[model samples]
Target: MKFVIHDRNNAIKVIDSDKDQDSVVKGRFVQDVLYELASKNSMEFIGWCHKDLEDFINHDQLNSIFHHELIMASYSTTGDYEIPEAIGYIENSTTFLNVKPDVNYPTWLMSSDIGGMHAMVILKFENLKGSTKTSFDGFLNHISKTALSEGLFCYSSPGLLKKDSVSIESRQNKINLFYFVRHHYRSRWLPLLFLDYLLYEK
Candidate 1:
């Protein structure tokens, strides 16, 4: 399932999904989109690939708790094919935006918009609902305190909320997902770090 994230700092930067806004875009449309997003949001950009995840873990200098495996990667780009419109939400003041990822080929996927001063990490897993509540709570506890305060919301065949077990119907039938937000800048990576814990235990 995808989490549709919205950030006040980053609105949906419209891509000319149509012609006319044509630029020599190729290879990494996702990166291009991300860079554009970062530029718009005025944040530094770091585009990590599948290989980067593994490589970062092996490197000594970049010994970070954050890794690539914890992130949901998207393959489709505007460079290879037509890039479609991306819709993200902005919390009333534009501080928070829940941007759910669009579908990709073969296996469905999700994405995290890690821009602005805040970092984001989106994790995709199967059978989470069927899993135990302790499993989820463990994930919530593992992340930084700031993330815990912001809490999380689950989205799926029927959207669910962690704060309140409310199920909202979603047009997208196949994906089920939730979003955990970390409001404190210092603990931003806590949610992403907990991803490995969730995958291993559940």
Candidate 2:
């Protein structure tokens, strides 16, 4: 059974999840995408990673976040792919994702529009209805506290919130990525820190 939740942050973990012969080929492509994205996100956000900085989400880091549902449950549990068109939500800190599963060669060929004001991972969910409660909760938790909050009245949506048309931008070589890190972190230092520079940069 596959976890309904997915993201580029741990694309390798996802890649590692499957060990089929096909995954071998796809995994290589995913690594290339990861290399490109982790480098850009780090470089823009904190002036780290000069095309060869080794701090993209490590194996341990992936293990730490593997149980996203569990950690997020304490977080009031919540929450795509090619996603030719889906109501995507982003704030800042874009992540790379041209495709999901990245397990098939077909997906690799499909172009991606991963740019956004938020950290995004390219993913694809087949037969998503099976995990509605789990997936939706994950989705809500992902985008929660993001809409509006006068500090007193935080708003939420009962149904799925989606957009008819979505657009993607290029974050390559962009800067000030640290500026928006505060808005997304769960009021924590490590999260923002990790996103900006990962485990290294003291």
Off by over 4 Å in 1: 1-14, 17-20, 41-202
**Cα lDDT computed for each candidate against the true fold:** 0.24, 0.23
Question: Alpha carbon lDDT of residue 128, candidate 2?
Answer: 24
Q: Report the C-alpha lDDT of model 2 over 1-202, residue by residue, as the tens digit.
A: 1111123212222222222221222222322333343344432211011111122212232233222221111110011222111111223312224423212111111112211111122111222223323222222223322322312111111111122223223122112223233334444643545454433333
Q: Per-residue lDDT for 36 in model 1?
A: 46
| Position 20, candidate 2: lDDT | 28
lDDT of 1 by residue, 105-191 (tens): 221122221111112321111212233332222222123222323432211111111122222221221111122223322354555
CA RMSD of all predictions: 18.9, 19.5
lDDT over C-alpha atoms for residue 148 of model 1: 25
Best by lDDT: 1
- Please give the TM-score that candidate 2 achieves against the real structure: 0.18
